[model samples]
Target chain A: MTNETASAYPGVSALVHKHLPKVPFTADKTLTDANITVEPAHFLELMQGLKERRELAFDYLRNVVGIDMQDEGLVCKYQLHSMKHRHSIQVTVHTPPGNPHIPSLTGLYAAADWHEREAAEMLGLVFDGHPNLKNLLLDEDVRIHPLLKAHPLQKMEIAQGIEDRDPGFKF
Target chain B: MTVWPEERLVTADAFNTVDMTINVGPQHPATHGVFRMVLTVDGEMVVDCEPYIGYLHRGLEKLTENHDYRQSMGWWDRTDYLAGMACEMAYCMAVEKLGQFEVPERAEYIRVMMVELSRILSHLMFFGAFGADVGSFGTSFIYAWRERERIYDFFEEVSGDRMFPTYFRPGGVQMDLPENYEDRVRWLLGSIRQGLEDFDGLLTGNEIFVERCRGLSPVSQEQAVDWGLGGACLRSTGLAYDIRKVEPYSVYDRLKFDIPVGKTGDVFDRFIVRMAEAWQSTKIIEQCLDQMPKGLVLNPDLPKTLRIDSGECYIRTEGTKGEYGVYAMAKGGNKPYRMKLRSPSFCNLSALKQMVVGHYVADAIIILGSLDIVLGEVDK
Candidate 1:
């Protein structure tokens, strides 16, 4: 990275450095701007700090993206912005192989309710404390995570279920 | 002895009054496009609301992940269908920032002009629809439609399509403005200003419309921020936060325009904030047209296929609705690994339950209308 590019997100990096020294998060530069990876165990603590800290008040939960890494595990990415300070950060939590569970942020940020549901339904990453984690944009009865790498793009072949037939969408 | 029904009270469980659940829209006009909500009402007042979105979901992120960067442009425009060019600008800015490409100065100015026009277009839609919500019926819709049709004709003259023009590319625009485009746009601006004046006389000047919206659903600034409301919703809380003024992307830093804010953050404040913003957008367009340089519209050094070795970033723009943000991750490929949109309507719509729980059923409809959510953006 160039000097200019590396120095862009100083607020995020500085906030992470000053507040969370022992939380097992490294300020990885190669990832997206303000990328911080934490274990599922320390995820809630770190996230609560990020939202509650006065100087680094990351209040608004923007988007939640869930990814399936196949061999590694399932991962959830959270984009947060502070309306007060106008700084942004991305928090990445990687779950274990068999256990794809992470604590939900619906309590901390009310905006996380729908976003967490979308992430859960898309990639099958289970949010632990979410009140409603049922299908959001997909069929209410359909039980599948189509955005996973293993799921094929809909082709000429008919997929598994009966409700998978068309879904009656209008323009 | 005679007893009055108004003073009569039932003890414990005699002749119990049950809470009734009513479903509004998936087809109804009041709920806007394809959105459904189940309202649990106790008599006339709503006690709970469960919003069911996704009727308009097209899996935009999944499709964008599979296609090349340029191929995803058409799909993003459909997200905020009312403001296609605004969505285009956000998508292109994300791609350009990811690839570290340079956009020409002339292209920047043109992009701003088109986006501000889109802002006006979307705000006009709110005025028309919100007026219909508050019982103006066909009058306000027709008044707003007149100006929209003129703007659409101008857009067709430039891009050959009325909606979803897909006119923006990674580095800049698909093409330059046509001959005498300035004269035509200036005429359109005159027409837009006239339309605004008529709307002001019709709705804002009317006593009933202001009376209906003045004190409905008043929101505190802290509550608005916590609920993640954006665009007019946030500004209506008397907070002077606008992405254009706060985080000056593109050529907005060079231009000057005031951020219109509300005093009480009620339904009336939300309505007027957008109305005042329409005037500011006009000012922005005038400045952009005057200062635009004469040069190439597209970058000369762009690659045939955009490929980032490995880079990712979040690009945000002040979309007509709010902070329309795109988070793009490209890891050594032409296709994006993950592309997520933080749509303003989706975040703003999530606050419906909190906003609608205590109001009367009729007032609840007006409150939802005041939110002005596009289902396309919400479901995406």
Candidate 2:
């Protein structure tokens, strides 16, 4: 948040927000040199660009986590570092109240696999391209997201109807 | 590679070249405590290896959500049972940072002493396990464990639990060091040094250990960095970067110690790095003891329930294994709506398959041993 910390990693904001306008669903942008905040859609491309460019080369995907904001929904936050550039940035993908989904960054970072699995299991966020989409740190049959503000009871008969009615199911 | 003369072992026929599939535990000795690895093998050489975790997953993350901030300290102790004090310290620092609580100088010194002592104990386990993996078996392991027991005694005396010491609180340690603690720790320091000397004679210079370890599983520095390796694993790759040095959390900036590195990132280099680090940890404990102060162990300013004033912060600290982080978001509520743990072993273990690719099956155990993963922390 301080100027010194911001200036410590110079030009990070420009590098992150270069392709920001192209992406849909972006929120308020904090273009500090140390950190940047972009919407979830922009986050995927920003990570992709960071990986390809030799100047950026943010190869190490350290952590991906989901945070529950009450009244609001889940926020998927990612921390990335370029060991080559000696810089770090945080990206957040905010999801609204009822349904939370974010583009899976596992293709960009293999370490994102287990982390995405953890987030999906904990917050019920469906990652579009995760290789293994099963539960992590919880039983497979768990019907509720533990980290949510409301402890969603199974209401078995009704919940099953909603799950079955999901239009994405081709079968 | 010459094939064995037996036609049944060497044949292309399915009936002759029968490769038995074995599930080598949620309880195998080499799987390292409740970790199940389904191995498909062809006569002692592994064709495929699939690691299955969660045998020790007691849902600590979900369980912590139900408890208060103070109550969560007990759960942190159980996560990394080997480096229990480090786990306690990391979680405590997260809560303190969130609440803006300041620890007394005395408590800092005690924590430094206790954590360094635990670091030595953990490295000893690494040594013992590495030796056992390299086929020295009980000879070196029992010797390392023998010295480690004395350090456990000191932990028990202070924290009241030998294995999992829930001694660190939000702002400081649970209690002051017990009477005559200095004498006991000093004695341990000497005894552990002597034990290291004996351990060196048993395993370090021996031809078998040298041959099995020297050139096997050599991870390039770029690969290590790409995989997010930390602690001794990163140190062994000539990085010379330690979280204790770069990040400077706790009293690490004030303390003086060398970050040992290796020329070639092999199993032997890892062993050397850990051995040298044990001596460095001893040096740190001595300094912490010398600069020991007298004050309150817990901060009186810290509230019983932590309700940080409307914000989110991600705090990271150097655990004995690597960077153990706690990400806490407070909506000014008594319990956190979200808490994410960034465990080091999970990242380090992600690199396991890559490290073992070209190496023989025998060398895989040694490679994993060098990584020094605690499965509980890895799965959690």
What residue pairs are clashing in model 2? none
Residue-by-residue lDDT tens digits, candidate 2, B190-288? 998998888888888899889888887787887777777877887788878666766577788889998899977888888898899889999999888
Model 2 lDDT at residue B70 = 83
lDDT per residue, candidate 1, B1-380, as tens digits?
87868647766767778999999999999988999999999999999999999999888988998999999999999999999999999889888877888898998998999999999999999999999999999999999999999888877887888888888898889899999998778878888999999999999999999999999999999899888899999999999888787667899989999999998889999999999999999999889888989999999899899888777777778899998988787877899887889899998999999999999999999999999899999998
lDDT of 2: 0.74
Which parts of model 2 have CA positions greater than 4 angstroms off?
A: A1-35, A97-99, A139-144, A152-171, B1-20
TM-score of chain B in each prediction: 0.97, 0.92
Q: What TM value does chain A in model 1 reach?
A: 0.85
Which tens-of-lDDT digit does each residue in A1-171 have in candidate 2? 111223444366566555444544333322222555556656677778777778777887767888777677778888776777666666677777777778887787767877888888777888887888887556566555655545433333343455554332121
How is the predicted docking of candidate 1 categorized under the CAPRI scheme?
acceptable
TM-score of chain B of 1: 0.97
DockQ, model 1, C-alpha based:
0.44
Best by lDDT: 1
